[model samples]
Target: MPDTGRSERGAVSAARTRDFARFRHEALLLKALGISKPLIACMAQRAAVTGTSIETEVLASGAIDEEAYYGGLARMAGLPFVAEIPDGMINDGPALDCQLKEPTLVRLHCNGRAPVIALVPKITHIEGLASRVKRSACLGETIVITTPSAIRRAVWKAGGERRGRVAVHGLFQATQPLSARTVVTGDQGFSAGLLISGLLMLLALAPQLLMIILHLILSLFHLGGLMLRLAVLAHTRRHGSEHETMLQSADMALPIYSVMVAIYREAAVVPQLIAALDEIDWPRSRLDIKLVCEADDLETLAAIAKVRPGPHFEVVEVPAMQPRTKPKALTYALAGARGEFITIYDAEDRPHPQQLREAYHRFRLSSDKLACLQSPLVIANGGESWLSAVFALEYAALFRRLLPALGFYRMPLPLGGTSNHFRTAALTGCGG
Candidate 1:
């Protein structure tokens, strides 16, 4: 009997040694797998040293409590212990009576050396439990838990609270009205009232009459200009080679010409303008293309920035204080002009390639009194819509028929808005 007892004790000692050996091996594996040291330690406490058995419990509310078992396995296998809590656990309360009654589970998802706990409680008492847990855990270090729906509700409540706080602080109120008295003489008051009434009447009637008069004047001017340009073209054809020779000789003396494009809220048409400019036959290096833009216009700024307008392309941000008009912007840009000749193109302009060359030649041959040469603006997209069709016809009569006639007669030419090339010095002389 004595011998048998001694033999049993020896066997038990060997078994203990084997269990320790297995545990050490498992711990080494967990370290190699990047499992956090703290989590591994917690798992080792709950699990059997040798990893022979795993304990699992399904709580009363149908949540599986495999923390102890999985934690241990993770330690042994060197893997993270992740728990996927059911959605219902957060939505529904826990069972009425259980060992861990009203228990809240905190689950966290994380990277690095920290353990994350996301909590799902199965009972009403656990409703506000996460906030308390978060506060306490935050005091130690930090713990992030998933509570999306709860967080959303909290944010909404916070917004309402802020609104209520603002409501309490009412708007400022003036204590008293400002006082001033009018010292009106009888004649002055009567005269003032009569003047105001007259002004109102004029405002009502004057615009229509003014518009009619302006239209009549514009029509007459346009007709006269057109007729003159045509006559000039005819005369030039008859006069011939002398003028052509004079122009070719002048090109050698003049500096490269520059084109100025003024844009404001014109993002839609800018790309088309760029495409047209690119298609022009002029040497790119010789063309100084200035794209003038208002400083405040973001859309146009962004669109223009994306275009890699090679060496000759320059973006000039015009100050807002300048007159808020296309002509004003052009005038401002002209102040910095370096070319011997300059031309203006609107955001939608598509000038003929030969237009610049033609203008340059004309200026070279003509007298300095020909300060400005107005080029005909042909509407390319004329028949696309009713508005366009009318515009096309109007332009055809103005450019093709009338302007040339006006030039021939040497009459004062009211310039077309765009594609009007001028001798740079002449334009600068005309109020820049």
Candidate 2:
């Protein structure tokens, strides 16, 4: 209460100083390994941008003093310094079980090259290392090595030959270059209008264009049908008092609700899923949340058990079946559900607190024909990369704009994979 704002600013400044010092120390260690200053600068910038700390420890055989290297890096980067060498280094015996426990931004500099690995979580297992390396490849990071055995193994695994004499350090490189062709195309409204106008002009000029005109008219009629459906949906949403009354009646009945989450090999995402469910604003007593897992997925089962959720949290083991996909698993879970209403959420989804309430309101207001109310599903980590950004934008356009427009017109919804709230009776009747 006493100047809290000033204290917060001071804390932030101290954190930044610590970050700068860490970067400098790591850079000096890399220099001792024969990594260039320019490369170190690039790595430092990458690390700074990603908000990750750098650490380097010398092996027992190495002559380089860890403290001196750390200090040199800090001095070069123009930041405050601190260093502590752990008992183990990368070359330590039998690769000790070091956990990369935090979501880290790693900038690797070997020789004169720099590579960046973003949003890498603390890895606990040796098996996870290969997957991490593969993911880094997907992100287009350069791999460089100052150590001979490390480079040899990496090169061999990568199917690259060691050129010339056996050197202590070597570099592997890749980058995700920005491509103009990869950008999503904008709306083609003008071109479509021009095409329609030209067709009309042609029909006006040709008196014997009756057959072509008839075909065009038929096409227009089909389009009009689609438009009419949209119009009906819009009208229903805006003016259907009867619909609202029906939903209200349903709410008055106060039926129980169940939420199903269909998962495959999603052990990594289960923690987040449970966390999201825990944050749901609905009454916990009435909430029956199911974690539908495949029979063979031991990892997911283990992860679920680790959480040790309450009775409301049910772990449903799906039998091995053909077409082992989410929809199939959900179909199986739906058969056993005892709730009046059912909803689906994905492993990575972070649904809004009031989502269930909004869906209930929609149901209570509408007739049975409005069996499903699909809440918009958005990418929570959309800005992580260009691919994710585009994926997020596409979803936003579909769920927020296009789907609503379609619903307004009473057209059949293409049905998104998640956030679909359903009346159990209506869904069962429709063979859902």
Q: Candidate 1 on 121-160: residue-level lDDT in tens? A: 3222222443454456552233323232232222222233
TM-scores for the candidates? 0.44, 0.44
**200-243 in candidate 2: lDDT tens per residue?**
78777874685677789999999997786576556556755232
Q: Residue 239 in model 2: shift from native, Å?
A: 12
Question: Model 2 compared with the native: what TM-score?
Answer: 0.44
Cα distance off (Å), candidate 1, residue 12: 99
lDDT of 1 at 280: 57
Q: Each candidate's root-mean-square deviation in Å?
A: 29.8, 23.5
